[model samples]
Target: MHELGIMTGVMESVETAARDAGATRVLEVRLTVGEMTEAIPDALEFAFEALSEQNELFDGAKLLITMVKPHSCCLACGAEFDHDRFHMFCPQCDSFALELLAGRELHIDSIEVDLPDD
Candidate 1:
């Protein structure tokens, strides 16, 4: 699954951030995933667990995932609506022309870290 690669990138970024911030350890990570992303939360969790074991920075760190629903705007009627992955049409105008406003995002929202005692 691509989740492994994605989680790898996430860990790298987190570690880099923690290092740059002079943090002793990473406590938690929150990721925002859109409906359009094929990455599964469970799969990502599995990857994170497997990959984070060797790194003390992420040891015992909690992984939190937030899922976002897809929203689109109808080009014809200029109407915005929430829709599922299977549909990409306007509800009001029933037109196939649609502009995706959301549901294609995959990024780290926030990271909790334990700073070194100054």
Candidate 2:
């Protein structure tokens, strides 16, 4: 699954940040998955668990994901509606020319790390 590669990249970035901050271990990684991203949260988590086996920093890290729904704005009637990739038309005026407001956001929201003691 594509989630494997995506999770790998995420973990890499998290690790880089953790290292820069002098962290010896990553405790948790929080992500926000938008409806339009087409990413499976469970699959990503599974991939993280599998891929992190060789990595000491993220070996036992927790992954938390939050799903965000797609939103659309109609240009014709200046209306907005919750949208999905399958149905992008505006609900209020049945307009096909709807601009997406929020969606397709696959980002790391927060990272918790254990810093090395001084």
Candidate 3:
């Protein structure tokens, strides 16, 4: 799955950070993903687990994901509202002309690691 590649990138980035900070091992990872990004949490978790088992630094690391719903503003009425995935329209003016304000993000929020001295 594409999630495997995504998870690999995430682990690589976090591992670099953890190593730079003198960490011996990663303990946890927190990520923020938007609905519009279409990254499945379950699949992401599976990928993470699979990668963790293959990596020495992330063998026991935990992954925590936070989902952000799509938020949009109607271009016609300038009204902001949550975008419904099924309808794909602005609720305020019922218009299809919308500017997405959020829900297209995928980033690491935080990482917990075991420092050499700790």
Candidate number of the best lDDT:
1
Task: Please identify model 1 stretches exceeding 4 Å from their true place.
Answer: none
Count of backbone collisions in candidate 2 = 0
Per-candidate TM-score against the hidden true structure: 0.95, 0.94, 0.94
Worst 10 residues of 2 by lDDT: 83-92
Residue 29 lDDT, candidate 1, scale 0-100: 97
Q: Against the correct fold, how does model 3 do in TM-score? A: 0.94
lDDT comparing candidate 3 with the true structure: 0.89
What C-alpha lDDT values do all the predictions have?
0.93, 0.89, 0.89
lDDT by residue for model 2 (1-118), tens: 8899889899989989999999999999999988787888899889989977979998678999998899988999999888777998888888898788888889999999999889
Model 3, residue 50: distance off in Å is: 0.2
**Overall local distance difference test of candidate 1:** 0.93
Clashes of 3: 0
Report the C-alpha lDDT of model 3 over 22-117, residue by residue, as the tens digit. 999999999998888788999999999988888899978899999999988889999988864666787666789988898988999999999876
- Point out where model 3 deviates above 4 Å: none
